[model samples]
Target: MDVLYFAWVRERIGLPKEKVESQAATVNDLVAELSAREDRYAAAFADLSALRVALDQELSDFDASLAGVREVAFFPPMTGG
Candidate 1:
């Protein structure tokens, strides 16, 4: 799957996107896997509540299924003035 990072997430992870080989069943599972990889990943995914996820370009929750998903994007909630 291609995991994309936006805004500060990209800053923390130091990448805009990357192809990931994961056996995760849900978004949360993927997060845990990434968080365990290194300190940077851990810091990037430290607070789930502060982040928002998108699956294949559609807004999704952390517990959403990852089956058949090709792309996953992580970013902070948007705000409009």
Candidate 2:
């Protein structure tokens, strides 16, 4: 899957996106896997409440299924003025 990070998530991870190979069944599982890989990933996903997720561009929850999903994006909740 292609994992994408936006805004502060990207800043923390030090990259915009990357292809990941995993056996995760949900977004949260994927996060745990990434978080185990490094401190940067841990920091990026430290607080799930501070972030939002998308599966193939559609908004999804951390517990959402990852089956058949080709892309996953993580970013902070948006704000408008």
Candidate 3:
């Protein structure tokens, strides 16, 4: 899967995107795996409420299944002026 990070998430993880190999069944599971990898990943995924997720370019919940998903994007909730 191609994992993408945006805004502060990109800053924390130090990458815009990366291909990930995992056995995670859900978005939350993927997050736990990444968080266990390093401090940067932990910091970026520390508070799930502060962030939003997209699966294959569509908004999704953290508990959403990752089956057949080719892309996952993480970013903070957007605000418009």
Candidate 1 achieves a global lDDT of 0.97
| Runs with alpha carbons beyond 4 Å of true place in candidate 2 | none
Worst 10 contiguous positions by lDDT, candidate 1: 72-81
C-alpha RMSD of each candidate structure in angstroms:
0.9, 0.9, 0.9
Per-residue lDDT for 2-78 in model 1, tens only? 99999999999999999999999999999999999999999999989999999999999999999999999999998
Give the Å error, residue 39, model 3. 0.4
Error of 3 at 44 (Å): 0.7
Query: Candidate 3, residues 35-58: lDDT per residue as tens digits?
Result: 999999999999999999999999
lDDT of 3 at 78: 87
- Pick by TM-score: 1 or 3, better one: 3
TM-score of each: 0.96, 0.97, 0.96
Query: Global lDDT of each model?
Result: 0.97, 0.97, 0.97
Question: Candidate 1, which segments miss by more than 4 Å at Cα?
Answer: none
- lDDT minimum window of 10 residues, candidate 3: 72-81
